[model samples]
Structure formats: C-alpha cells, structure tokens
Target: MSVESKTNAQVMTRVTVIGAVVDGLLGLLKIGVGFVSQSHALVADGVHSLSDLGTDVLVILAAKWSNEEPDANHPYGHDRIETLATLILGSVLLAVAGGIFYDSLQRFFDPSVAIELGIAAFAITVASIVSKEAIYRYTRHYAQLLNSKLLMANAWHSRTDALSSIAVLVGLIGVSFDLIWLDALAALIVAVFIAKIALTLLWDAMQELIDTALPEDQVTAIRAVALDVPGLRDVHHIRTRTMAGKTLMDLHLQVDPRVSVSEGHEIGCWVAASIRAQFQEITDITFHIDPEDDAEMDQEGPTSLRPLRREVLECLRADWGPLVDDAQIRLHYLRGAVDVEVVTSQPVTADVLKSKSRAVWLGRVTVLHPTVGDN
Candidate 1:
C-alpha cells in the first residue's frame, strides 16, 4: 500500500474508534434514564446510538481491508469492499427505522402508556445532543479529506443521533407540561429522519456497485484534457467507470498514419500523463493508438479484414517488378486500405506503379529512388 493510503486508513480507524467509545457510553446512559423516566423518545434515540456502534465496526474493518495492496487474484485492489459495507450499513439502518416507527405508533395510540419526565431526563438529552454533534463534525472533516463514501455515511449517521436527541429533549419538555402523546410523536419524527439518511446512502452505494459512469461535466473535462496532447489527431470511444471514489478509463487515439510505431506509442503516453495530471482520481488508463477513427465502422470492417504485413508484401513482390526485396517496401494500413512505398536504384514510372493488378484493398502507391548509392 502507498503511504498516503496507509495514512488515510489510520485516520479512519482513529475516528471510528473515538466515535464508538462515545456511542457506547451515551447509549447506556440514555437507555437507562429513558426507562426510569418513561420517555419513549429517549429510548428510541438510545437505540439509534447503539446502532452507530455496529456501523463503526463496519467502517474500521473496511478501512483496514480495502487499503491492502493489489494482489494477483484482484489486480484492481479492494476498494469495492468499502462500497459493500456501506450498503450493509444502510440496510441495517432501514430495519432499525422500521422498528422504531412501529413501536412509536403503538405507544402513541395506547391511552395507558404515560410518560413522566424530570430534571434527570432533560439533562441526559442535552448531553447526548452536544456529544453526538461534536462527533459528527469530527468524522465529516476527515471524510471529505479522504473522499471516502463510507466515512461520509458514518458521519451522517452520527448527526442523525444528535438530531434525534433534540427531539427527545422537546418530548421531555412536553411531558413535564402533562402532554402524554408528545413523547411517542417525537420518536416517530426520529424514525423518519433515520429512514431518509439510510435511503440516500443505499442509493449512492447501489450506483457505485453497478459501475455507473462519472458525471457528464467530468467526462467532458477529461476529453478536453486528452485533446490538448500534441500530435493527436482525434480521440474517440472514451469509456469510464467509478470504483469506490476513483475512476478507471480507456479510449482510442488517432494519429498520423505515416508516423513510426515508437512515435505513436510516445504520443499515447503523453496523453495519459496529461489526463492524470488534470484528474487526480483517475488511477488506471488504457489508450488504443489508431491510425484512423474506426468508431462508426462495423465489427468486421476493413481494419479487421486487412491482410497482414507479410501477406501484403508477398502479393506486391509477385505483382510489381519494383517490389522484389522486402527491405525496400513499407506498408501503412489506414481506413481499411493499404498505402505502399517502394525504394530502388532502378528507374521507375508512375504508370508501372499504377498499372499493376491492383487489389481492392490497395489505396495509393509511391516509388522512391535510392540517393547517392551505386549498385
């Protein structure tokens, strides 16, 4: 693993461990006080805090496992593990929300279920609100620094607990004024808040799981960066997908047909470097050097059906008197046709180059005379 990746993992681990410790303490206090004081909202909020502990475990494990270096079995690394864990965390929240909603509705309708609130309940609710809010801010800061979806989800999870505690505080005030049903109503509101955050996390994880493309604006920016590379005629067939928060891309680049193979390869490398410099998230790139644009061509186009270099040379030698030696012949395959060049010391004519039995795949032919060298 790179030093940066290892540092990120360590940061995530430290943040989650701190949050877990706070969650464990607050959950026990809220649940205990809630039962003693008959506050349904407080109990529901306590359950929410405990649920956060479970997701904290998920985040820690994902951070450690996903940061491992790529192995032979998995060449792309294990970033997808974080995505899967995010999905699971969302599912767990959804189930917790449903349970809270059902219990709150039942308590709200029952006439005998009464809430008795005192100074103890109010003090606990206030403490929970302050503690959870602090944890939320801390986690969110690191999440943006690392650009981690899983950490972001956990950060929101902590904020929801703080918001739920606010609802509990309001319910406790109402119970103090002899309003019995307000405690259950507060719990129901907490359930709704949990469900909304859970659904959002679930949707984002699903999009990444299915390999959705990056946004259109980012793709356009990528194309612009690629076109700025020198010696590139055009670029086409740009394909992209996101894994975790990183991008993977492949594209086709067109260059001059007469350029040497080494030159074409150098151009491709320059394009890749330019793109990576512009977009830091793009870690993997594959470029296909093309002599011509073949995006609109069929699968069995002339590029695929064209003869190999050796076959083309044998045909040229048999048909043309000037093409007797392979050393003097050069061939370029472009746009489904072959352009041939022949070099010799003997005198040659345009008619001889053109009047030969031309194959359907041949496009243009040129003859060059050896300079300053006697036979």
Candidate 2:
C-alpha cells in the first residue's frame, strides 16, 4: 500500500477509537449531570459531543475510501475522496452551528426560564476540555508530520470541541451569578466559531479538489534544482500539485540541440533524480525536452547571431598575441568589411599589421584599414 494509505489508516484508527471512547464517556457524564442539575447548556454540549462521535466515524469512512489505489475508472485515484469528506464535515458543522444558534436565540428571547448549574457539570466540562485538547495535539502533530489534510481538519475539529467545553465552563459560572442568558450566549458563540472553521476548511479542501498548484516557493525551489542540473540550459513550464500526501510535477527542459536523443534522455533523468533527491515530496515528475535553440526561440528569438565586432577582436587577440594595445574591431556587415585599429608597444609598420590581419582573417574576414592604428 502507498504511504498515504498507511497514514490514513493509522490516523483514522487512532481518531475513531479515541473519539468513540472519550466522546462516549463525556456524553454520558454530561447528560447525567445536566439532567440532575436542570442545565440545558450542559445537555446541549453533551449532544454536541455525541454528534462528534458521528463525525469521527465519518472521517474514518472517508479516509478509508480516499486511500484506495487508482483504478481504470478513476485514473487519478480516490485521493479527492478525502476532500469530499472534508466538505461533508464542513456542511455538518454549518448545520449543527445553525441549529445551536437558533436554539440559543430562542432561549435568549425567553428570559423567564432559570438556568441551574451543578459542581458535577462544571467538572465534566473541565475533563472534556482536557481530553479534547489531548486529542487535538495528537492529531495535529501527526497531521503535520504526514502532511495529511484530512487529519489536520479532524485535529481542528477536536480543537473546536475543546473551545466549546471552555464556553460551557464559563456559562456554568455565569449560571451561579443568576446570569441565565450567558449560557445560551456562550453556546451561540461556540456555534459561530464552528461555522467559521467549517467555511475555512471547505474553501481549502475545494481548492485541493480542483488540483490547485503548490505554493510559489515550492515551485521556485523545484525550478532552481532543475536549473542546477548539468547540461540543462533552462527550465520552464513547471507545474506542481498535491495528491494523497505526495506532489506531482511536470516541466520542460532545455538542452543543447547537438545532444543525441539518448543523451537528452539521460540528462532529463539526471535532472529528475536531482530534484527528487533534494525534495522527497516530489513523487512524480514528467519532463519534455526541447533543443536549447528552440527553447530560446520560443521565449525570445534566435540567439544564433554573434557580435561580429567582438568575434573579430577575439580572433586578432588569439592569432597576433596581446602585443597589440588599444585594439578595436568594428564591423560594417553591409560592406562585408571589418575596421581594425591597434596601438603596439613597438612601432610596427601599417603594412606589417595588415599582413598579420590578413593572416588572422584566413580569407573570410576582410580587414578594411591597417592605417586606423592609434600608435
């Protein structure tokens, strides 16, 4: 099985098992204490915990289905199933938040009812906070280490539960002060927080489902590695995306046109190897090779034309040595002649310099005037 599959299975197993145990026990305790103390807020919070049990089960189901290997029917695999699950979870959160807000609003309008608080309800809320915090930490640590989006979402879910418990604790204290409206108000705030978390998660997961590109920095790092490869002139058309805890990339590589097909292929393989070695996150790479000339032309224009003046100067220096000082070569391509000027340490006749220029030219380059010498 793939690393994603293993991680999903492990996270789901741990989360489901722990969630069932903690939520079950907390739900029972809160309900029992709330009923005896006549605390509606405690009862509502207990119901929320019960709802979490259902959500945890949903997470496990989603993780399992999402980790399935790619099939003919699903060429890209079932990775987006995790995103679908996150969307579902988000919807669930929104609905629950709406329900909680509505109930809290109704309670707010009815000021005649009195809220009762008990020591047992307060203790249960504290215990729930501790337990949920532990779950959040555990899930978040693994989520980051494995880069599992689904697990990270679930971790925040646990964190929201802890926050809700804190709200419950404050409400219970407000009840002691005869502030009956505070309990419902606190629950409403918790509901709003839950809704916000849901919206954020939904938006992020949707981006993933649509196969959004990885961050710019990551793409830049990949491109930098590609350019570092020997024999590679340039890298372009880099594209990257994430799927099931792995990254996939496709890019175009520019290499010398004179290189053979086998050599180009080898260079591409080396580039791919270098990138993967540097960044283990890249699980798949596809490269298209283009001739360096073709690639340059695609970006700008043909770079084949050399500076004739510079070439002539280089030719003079190579053939006649650096004995010629203040040397300059000017090209008049229209006239098919090169103007050469030189200052020699010793006095040299124009005829001797002309002979040297003709020798250096070897017939191709026409020397216009040796009389253009500075000294």
Candidate 3:
C-alpha cells in the first residue's frame, strides 16, 4: 500500500494508449468494409477489435485507481481494482466469442444467404492482421518488462484478434474461389481461440481472489532468504498471496529461547528486507517471532502447572531454599504452559538453578538477578 513508483504509472499509460488508438482505427476500418462488401467474417473480426478498445478503458481506470496510496477504506491500496479489471476483461472476451460463434452457426444453417467480396475488403482484412499482431507484440513486451498480469492478458487478447483476422482473410479468399463454407469455419475457430484465452485468464484471477499461494519455487526462495539470516533458528507457517501482481507474505520465525526481544525484532526486520531485495514483487511481509512452538495451548485460557499463585510460591521457596518477600514473579502463559521468572536481589548457584525437583514441578524456571557489575 505504499506509494506507487512513477515508472509503473508511466509504462501502464503508454501501453494502454497505444492499444486504444490502434484498436480503434482498425475496428472502424474493418467494420465499415465488412458491411459495404457483405463480408460477415470481417465484421466479426471488427467486433473483436472493438472489444479490445473496451478493455483498454478498463485498464486505464484500473491503473489510475490502483496507483492511489492506501486509504482509510482500502488500507491495502486499490490493487484489487486491477484484479477486478482482469475478471471483467475475461467475461467480455467470452461474451464476444459466444456472439461471434452464434452468428457463424446461423450462417452454416442457412445455405441461400447472399455472399459478396470486394478488392477493398481484401486490403482492410490484411491490414487488420498486420496491425493487431503489431499491437500484440508491443503490449506483450511492456507486459513482461512491468511483470503485469493484466497487461499480459490484454496482449494475448490482441493476438487472438489478430489470428482471427487471418481467418477473415481466408474467408475473403474463399469467396474468390467460390468455396463459401470456409468463411464460417474460420470464424468458428476464432471463437474457440478466444474462449480458451478467456477461461485461462478467469481461472488465474479467481485463484488470486481466493488467496492462493505462490508457486513452490517462489515460496522456497523466500524460505532460503530468511533461514540465511543470523540468529534465526527456523521458519514455519509461511504463507503468500498476490494483490495487483505484487506478492505479499507472512511467516513465523523461531529463535533461541534466550535471545532478547529487541534482537529478535531486529533480525525479523533484516529478513524481510532481504527477501524483498531478492524479489522486487514482494510488497509486504509480516513476521511473528516465537521462542518455541505453542504445542499444548488450551482453547479455554491460560493454565499454569500450579493453578494457585500461593501454591506456586510455596513450591518456589521449597526448591530455591528460601524466597525474599520482595521478589517479583512474572508469569508468561504460552503454549499451554507457564514460564516463571522470579526477579530477586539474592545470588543463586548454578547447581541450585538446575535442581531436578524444581524441574519436575515447574516445566521452565529462570531467575532474573543483577549482573556481576551491579552493587
């Protein structure tokens, strides 16, 4: 949800504008020529190009909104706006394919329909093929550079249209040779291609909406980065998802039981930065530091070995020889067990610190007293 860099906004704008202009001009020429010459195949291809124009508008809006910094309502930023655009793009492609297919099927059923071809139609159909293919290449190149899923969908969408125009050109040639059924067959093939692209895009976008994990290699790379950091014992519960083509992750990092809290926190920060440096697409990472796994956690609440505070005090006095009345006891309830730290001013021996009777009664015992330099 941080501020989007200027470079991303610039690339998205340039690619979208190029697609809109090229698609608009080509769509108009093909549709006009198709009707004047009574070429249904060219008209169908023209409609496909027009659909590209519609998606270009969606891309523009998605980019604008998604670039906005995180707001009160959308604390994650408007990244999902791009995903929504992708879904809409897929649905529109399917609808266009269905309509074209239905029209082509009708032509097959009706044999007496009049068919005509013109030299001008030939020129426009060839032009559509060349222009659309160029747009596809242009869009695809930038898509790879930006690592943008939405733009890549649009790129393949253009390619489908371009290939469909090739079908149109074949139909025009069929008319010249008096093989009228060829035009209908070509249109049907284009519909299949469009539908295939649509289904793929929809499936990928839906997975993201449901918070699917990244590929195994990507997750493994993240793990490698974290485990390489110093003072980290192990990592677990790693999770990842994408929003606006950027990966977001969260994981639990286990450290030594004796490490200080600040040191653990600093280590977590370093790990996050290291992963991000390796994968520029990773936008955020949340780290939960754990001294050990919570194995015996009770769903109800915190339960101590000695349920009564007085009982715990009596046991502590018996094990440690005697207790100072002013000693402070801090109970940490975790993983269905309590870690007891008794703050004292008296010195205790290592032998007494490792007493087996106390170990048997209390799972974990630690005494916090001043260092040797303290008076």
| Best model per TM-score | 1
True lDDT of residue 168, candidate 2 = 70
Show the lowest summed lDDT stretch of 10 residues, model 3: 294-303
TM-scores for all candidates: the values are 0.90, 0.72, 0.84
After superposition, which runs of candidate 3 have C-alpha atoms over 4 Å from their true positions? Answer: 1-4, 31-48, 111-115, 295-335, 342-362, 368-375
Q: How are the candidates ranked when ordered by TM-score, highest leading?
A: 1, 3, 2
Q: Order the numbered candidates by lDDT, best leading.
A: 1, 3, 2
Residue 8 alpha-carbon offset, candidate 2, angstroms: 4.5
Model 1 lDDT tens row, 1-375: 399889988999999999999999988887998888877756766776786788899999999998877899889888889899889888877886787687678878883554446787779878989988999999999989888889988888888778767766766676777776786788789889899999999999999899888888988999899999889999888889877788889999999878999999999999999999999989899999988878787345543578888888777767874455733777888767887777676677546876885677787777878778544
Model 2 stretches astray by more than 4 angstroms: 1-4, 36-38, 112-115, 292-375
Model 3 residue 138 CA deviation (Å) reads 0.6
Per-residue lDDT of candidate 2, residues 1-375 (tens digit): 578577767777676677668888888788888888887867877887887888888888877887787899997778777778878877776786687677667768985543457788878889999999998898888778767777778888888889778767777787788787887888789889988988898888887778899999988988898898889998877888777567888888988754768898999999999999998878789998876435435566443444465566667676667743354433332212334444334455556656666432333333333455443
Clashes of 3: 0
Choose 1 or 2, whichever is better by TM-score.
Answer: 1
Question: For each predicted model, how many residue pairs clash, with residues at least 3 apart or on different chains?
Answer: 0, 0, 0
Steric clash count of candidate 2: 0
